[model samples]
Target: MNLILKLIAGIVAGILVGLYVPLTGVELLYTVKEIIGQLLTFTIPLIILFFIASGIAGLPKGSNHLLGKTVGFAYGSTIIAGTLAFMLVSAIIPLFDGGLTFNAEVATPLSNLINLKIPPLMDVMTALASAFIFGIGISQLQLETLKKVSDQGRDIIDALLAKVIIPALPFYIAGVFAEMTVAGTVFETLQTFGVVLVAALVMHWLWLSVLYISTGVLLKRNPIELIKNMLPAYFTALGTMSSAATIPISLRASKANDVQEDVANFSVPLCATIHLSGSTITIVTCAMAVMFLSPSMDVPSLVDMLPFIMMLGVVMIAAPGAPGGAVMSALGLLTSMLGFNDSAVALMIALYLAQDSFGTACNVTGDGVIALWVDRFSKKAGS
Candidate 1:
């Protein structure tokens, strides 16, 4: 009940702020939104790193197969799902007549998508180091020695995030919407391309549902029952728009859907960290739209851009932690690899924010379905 109330309050507050922003002016909205965006940007990497490293470290040694299979399936499905989404959008967008062309003022250099500037080797080493530290730290602590203390840490983090951090989100969202609204940007920005945007979002949702259904069929599980069982988690994801935040509810839903407890416990945390179907789709769709819109560049043939699109998908998987990480990464790929301009990147960011919630819901739903499939497969192998 409390969760429901909080969600309702957040929505109502967000709408009110979005509506009020134009009346107030763009400067205030931009300032407020930028501040909030910066804070979120800062928190994202730390939270993701700790959450992933600790979770991986904490997994019991014997649980590697379950973990490995679950992660592998998630990554594979996300890549396939992203590619299918891109093809669907590519085919559908051309029907919208001249279809979302970009203004010349914003064009900049496109980056190479395949040759990512990998993070420093030290950062990778740090992640591994942190994982070991966390794993060993937990393993050494006797359950009786730290049970209550452990619970305290969990409770504190939960309270801080839920009570303090989350309530502020609507304000931030309002500020962003307001800035866009006041700039007379909403219609001009989305103008003529609303259909394409809608089509892309729908395709994302459809592909996610397809992934779930395919997994169900493969596992001999009832697809409708799978959807029904995951409703609480789905709704939670819809409201929160953060897969990391939705992990607990997703785990609960997986258990309800008959996933084994050990599998649920291991897979949900990993999925929350790395499973990003929604983000991947948003990045690709937005990037493509921007490319089509840009007036300066000779639009690359779809066949020509296929390699870059696939590379963008992989880069975005590692992007959840960076501020504007996904969009920046996509933009970098476009400019450095594909020769797209900066205007395209800006437009991509603007368009993507509009449909981010839908993308997040798709991501969480796919995670639940994958967890079920992994559990079923493991059971079969054991038998």
Candidate 2:
């Protein structure tokens, strides 16, 4: 009921903004929206840090096998789902006939820095090293009482995201939309490549369905039952478009799929923090499209950038944890690695935000599926 009201509020607010903004000529509205977005970007990192630290602290000590299986399944399944989705979308893009041409005018410039040429191998190593250091630090902080306090902190943060951050999303989205609409950014690009947009969205749905079905089959569970169990989480993610916001529902679905409580607690939060199948897929697909559309753009070859792409996908898991942080992170990668200008980043943002809900839904569903497989493997191994 609360979720429904939130959705309704977002839609109503969006409609109101859509209606009144043009008439009011509110020049400051976009500026205000950007400010709110910037605030979110700032908040997301703390949210991620606290959530991860607390979740790691709370994990049961004796559940290494369960944790291992769950983490492996989640990472493996995310890669599979992302690859399949990419393939499906790649195939479908040809059918769109959307007359989409990439315009370099949409590219954004990397701010005030000489392009530093970092080797892709070193870049990937740096990311892994950072993750390892964070993991080791969390592992060392294993005091039970501290864990409890951290868990409580996480709960409070979750409440804030749900009650406050989420409620503000629609307004932010509206502001983004209004700004884009006014700037002629929303419709102009999409109008030419509307088919590509639709194709990408459809591919998201198809891959999500495939992931759910695959989870059922792998776990020897009923597909319909799995879907039924996960529907609440799916809808929650769809509405919130934030996996962190949907964590509570995802934990519920994890349990419903027979994942042990200890394992579910550890894995679900970790997955929410790092397992960004939907976002990764969207970034790659969109980047590919941008490359294809802009023939003159000297984009890095896929073979040359594959390592970076994978690393970017992993780093992006840290993105949603910070408010509005993903864009900056993506821009960093695009400008530094892919040579994308600000216009390209803006267009990518437009494409990504327009279909973020579907991507989010996919991410949530993939998390649940991986949880189920992990639970089944744990049980079998114990037997």
- Candidate 1: regions farther than 4 A off: 1-61, 107-188, 298-306, 321-331
Best by TM-score: 2
Identify the candidate with maximal lDDT: 2
TM-score of each: 0.64, 0.66
Error of 1 at 251 (Å): 1.2
lDDT of each candidate versus the true structure: 0.59, 0.60
Write model 2 residue lDDT over 1-383, tens digit each, in one string.
Answer: 34435433543454455456653443344444555555444444444454546544544567678767766666666566556655665565556434666664522111222232323323423443544455446567655665566567657766666567656655655554454444444454445456556767776677777877776687677888878888899899877877889999999988987778876787787677667777667776777677666655754554665665665655554453423334434545665567775346545655666567777777787788777667677678872
* lDDT per residue as tens, model 1, 1-383: 33334433533453455456444344454455555554443333343334333444344566768867877887777677767766876776676536454453422121222332323223322433453455447655634344344334434434544555445555554444444444344344446447556866777768867876787788788888988888888788777767777889999999998888988988887776667777777776766665555555555666776676665544444344312334533544555566653334334554555566677777788888778878878898892
Where does the lowest 10-residue lDDT sum fall in candidate 1?
107-116
